[model samples]
Target: MSWARIMAPLSGGEGDATALAAAVRLAEPFGAEVAGVYTPADVADVMPWMGEGFLGGVQTTALESLKEAAAAGEAKAREAMSHVTYGKNAFVSLQTPVWSGLSAESRLSDVIVFNGDSARGRGPLAEAFQQMVADEQRPVLVARGEFSVGGPIAVAWDGGKEASRAARLALPLLEKASRVVILAAPKASSRTFDPTRLQAYYAARGVTAEIDILPDSGDAAPLLLYAAGKVGAEILVAGAFGHPRLQEFIFGGTTRSLLAAEAPTLFLSH
Candidate 1:
């Protein structure tokens, strides 16, 4: 296992459970530890919905609701841990206001998993994924409905340092794959790279992988996904990129699109 530990931020529900399962499956292969960081409800997300943040009864009720949700989420994490076969589990209780605490937690872990929650657009999970995987530059596995850890691995290679690092970080999964394929996008400029070099890099690590160029088409996400489908890859691993201007961050071209991907889980890093 390339990762010594992987963390799943539990939001309580099926998505969290699925993420936990994915993390455990990945961790177990290398005897890595799995930690579920439970953050039930952000006070900001709840307080606003609760209407006019107040004191006394209203405040008490809100606190109680938060506590109940937290407890249930912790229970869910514990239950999921119980079913995991090999990896050891640890629990973390974090109720961060702006998700800063969660972000900090991510820095120490090898990989983080969460649901895409794309329908909500740039919601918390989506933004958090971008923040961790793209902004703070960590490897993250974003899942939606149902996700399984092992299968033919598809890697999106762009020949940049980020993509190279991401491939290196995902070596364990690639090594385990029955088949490995690289999806390289058409280069927009003369400073282009050949995917064959990446394939050779993997060769040194004893992973047999081939490269395929995706259609230089309209939407990046769909095109990559379509190519991945052609290769029958179960999941995608890519390097995420984004930059901050003013107080906001703009996600990398393809990275933003993958956040909305539903069919396959995305394993990404910065």
Candidate 2:
């Protein structure tokens, strides 16, 4: 059986309810479970720094805001579940860093759903998003405009451990795809593609695969994006490059451009 999970960032800008709703729809057929996450509002000022007379007011305001946010999250979670089609089965839960302890648990999920914004909890631009993908070693799907996830899929492969991992992770969805394009791109080290070997890999798994080889260009992101769109790919799955220590590689040029691109990306990092 196939399973999927969507991580709603829970913020006014990036990880909000809209993305969660779309994630719910995407997970409908798979009967996936979804989790909502929100960063609690800052209350340190009210706790020890405020005057005794004003402390009560500050505490009340903070509590009210927290309640509102929690209520909104619950309502959105309910709404997301309402759109499910495959027997309308989905389990929803809310978690946080200090209280609900969701932050620790997100590392264990298979897939995380995040937004492009920087300030919305641990989103695509945040370190948590990268950790969720590369460090925690899971696939992260970033939500963008129009939220169309199911369609033609593009698989970026270099025959490395990372590329193979991405291909394997994408197998479930690839089997469901009407068309699957296997893209072999240029990388630094000595890497070659054995069409026969790859064909056997897919053949063994019952996937009739179509392959293409592209030149090693300076920027792989745009090239991959262009190729996917040309093939009418709605969901693009690729092995994410860049070392976790190098900020330039993680949140810098290539990653930013790819995440900012029009297509919804399923990223697996090495």
Query: Ten-residue segment with the worst summed lDDT in candidate 1?
Result: 242-251
lDDT, residue 180, model 1:
93
Give all candidates' CA lDDT scores. Answer: 0.72, 0.61
Please give the lDDT score at residue 93 for candidate 2.
Answer: 46
Per-prediction TM-score, please? 0.78, 0.71
Please write out the lDDT profile of model 1 over residues 9-123, one tens digit for every residue: 7655666666777777768877788888776567666666556646678688877887787778768767766666653888787765647788788888998877666222443
RMSD of each: 4.2, 4.8
Cα error of candidate 2 at position 30, Å: 1.6
lDDT, candidate 2, 5-103, per-residue tens: 655444333245555665665666576666555543334423455556654766678767866866665565555545444453344444433323445
- Per-candidate total of colliding backbone pairs: 0, 2
- Flag regions of model 1 displaced more than 4 Å: 42-72, 75-87, 95-100, 118-124, 144-150, 187-191, 242-252
Candidate 1 lDDT for residue 261: 62
- Give the number of the best model, judged by lDDT: 1
